[model samples]
Target: MDSEKELSGKTVLLMAIATGIIVANLNYIQPIEGLIADSFQVSKAAVGVVAMLTQLGYAFGLLFIVPLGDIFNRYHLIQIMLSLSILSLLLAFWAPSLIIFGVASLLVGITSVAPQIIIPYAAYLAPSLHRGKVLGNVLSGLLTGILLSRSVSGLLGSVLSWQYVYLIAAIACTILLGVLHLYLPRDPRQKQHMQYGKVMASLPKLLAKEKHLQGSAINGFCLFGVSNVLWSTLAFYLAHQYHFGSGVAGLLGLLGITGVLFASIIGQMVDKYSPRMTVGLGILFSTLSFVIFTSLGHLFIGLIVGIVLLDLGTQFGQVSNQAIVQSLSLQASSRNNSIFMFSYFLGGSLGTFFGTLAWSNFGWSGVCLVGTIFLVLALLGHLFLKEPEKLQKVS
Candidate 1:
């Protein structure tokens, strides 16, 4: 552990950028599915295997790997995981067939759990007053990476080759790996000496012990699921309803920059206000976004309006939710984060499934309704949780 307890701006910036770069690997294939399909002479839908496998791999790692942050030297774990991610990208870059690419993508997702470790580690380094603010900054970088990945991938696929994106990402990851190794401070907390099995077994206990964590995790799941419902089929909706190309569909990610900006501000708000209030405010925006999409999304302007609302609302809720969870147990921050993110992405997978079904059966209208239903459930779940009456006395 580093003797220094306070975080530096330079450290925060590196953490933020590293998180963004790591997470971008998961999204890089999304906008280039068509090019990948063309390369392998497969249907566009088949090319989705890379993205799906990557997500599944991430879920697996969250369940199995991220908890190690609680037990091992996190700095060592981070370096090992990031190096593995770089190798995965290299494999993906040279993949000759869809099958090999899918495998490599899965490895990339698994290794990308490095950021989950990084986030909690950052939380540990900050003062309680600024934890949310620091997390917000990191999440903004993550959001930028996710959004820009689609734009960059689309442009590269059009002008060069989709494989070039993976190659470039590999190079970027290598640079980030070296930087992180050279600069990141060691965790100040003493490492847990728990066995691997004990570490894995502790997750259920963590969930059972923390009602707030459960509430936040459930809320996160529903919110992320709602976002995925719209995102998974956005290109299809653009093509069918607006006669737009994939390039245009990719640009919708830029609308999410609104969310990125809000993430940092919302963190400050969470510290000044209550997490419950912030979450409620975010839910209002989410509900409004769905209402607009349902009634007026046929217009380009309406779709844009819906995109901004959804992204902003989701970020507000997410930042607040994460703040609440990270505050639960400092000793178990990584495990708590793992459970939270696992549920979050599981919700995403569910959303993708139901969104595909809704789009197939009822078109964009169904998508809107499904997303609304998710928000409603999330709101209700949040409402049912016991508010922290103690927090009222903090200030």
Candidate 2:
């Protein structure tokens, strides 16, 4: 493969598909937590610990595993991670105790960093002229997978069993692994001799030196925190308020596809306008979504509209912030991404933990309150912090 070759639409599409399949593993447990709770004879709130552990595991991988993309063969690394994901999923499928399942879930989160690897790899391959557009297309697929995973897990869990969701995910990953082996391009520019310790050490230096990275990381943290606040507890909310099952909670995830549909357009907007503008809009949409969730949440239609706005806001913030992060240094793209996403998922983990805590204590009102606080923090950062001058020029 030519290191300087421009990415083809077909190759980008394949990467998008591969990203979607690999990333879906992280989310399969959300809607089905209730089913797993029933099987393990645990409270619904207790099962949330498993969800939090998974997000923390993903944060750990972002810090430790994803930087290997800068040093090793990304193509081979992706395959190895996918294979490990299959094993982790299988472990989740067969575990008889909640403790073992929680361990497997953590492993699942750790190995599922392939999408993060793929994103930076795609950025390296894409022309700078079209990088935002390309990333948007790929993210559309990624978000689609995330939204669909809950739906599929809920339906499968309701019809069969929660354990079967992992079994099926394992099978899906096995197939995706073969597909990637056949189709994914190898990066010829990888540094075979880069020291792991140095790569890891540069992370803090990057965080300290890059003003845009710092601002974007904080935005990503708070924005994703808002997202998880809703997702981590959505199943319980549906069950409590409407007497719905996991199936309906999963099906409601479909509503968020409205935002997914606009991902590419948002990417184009990033290319045309500025990341700062899009990010601000994202924060506004997210804030509005919570307002709806807080006030009109008693109505099912309110949930539908709030979901659409929330997802749209998330796409705006995530894609724009990622574009800024990737543009920082092509040589250190993976490490840059690792720094940004580590904070991103760390916030998600905390959001899941605090969101569940709020739900346990104050019900839906508490969940909305938690999400609103995160959004408000994100909004304040966006308003007060100016993008680095270099980042403005790059955009």
Instruction: Compare the candidates by TM-score and give the number of the best one.
Output: 2
Task: List per-prediction Cα lDDT, in the order shown.
Answer: 0.82, 0.89
User: Where is model 2 more than 4 Å wrong at Cα?
Assistant: 1-6, 388-395
What digit string (tens of lDDT, one per residue) describes model 1 on residues 266-359? Answer: 8888878788888887788888988988888999999999989988888887888888888887788899999998887777767766776677
Model 1 scores worst on lDDT over the 10 consecutive residues at 386-395
Q: For every model in order, what is the number of clashing pairs? A: 0, 0
Tell me the deviation in Å of residue 92 in model 2: 0.4
In model 2, residue pairs whose N, Cα or C atoms come closer than 3 Å (at least 3 residues apart or on different chains), thus clashing, are: none
Distance (Å) between predicted and true CA of 184, model 1? 1.1
Q: How many residue-pair clashes does candidate 2 contain?
A: 0
The TM-scores, one per candidate, come to 0.93, 0.97
In model 1, the Cα lDDT at residue 260 comes to: 86
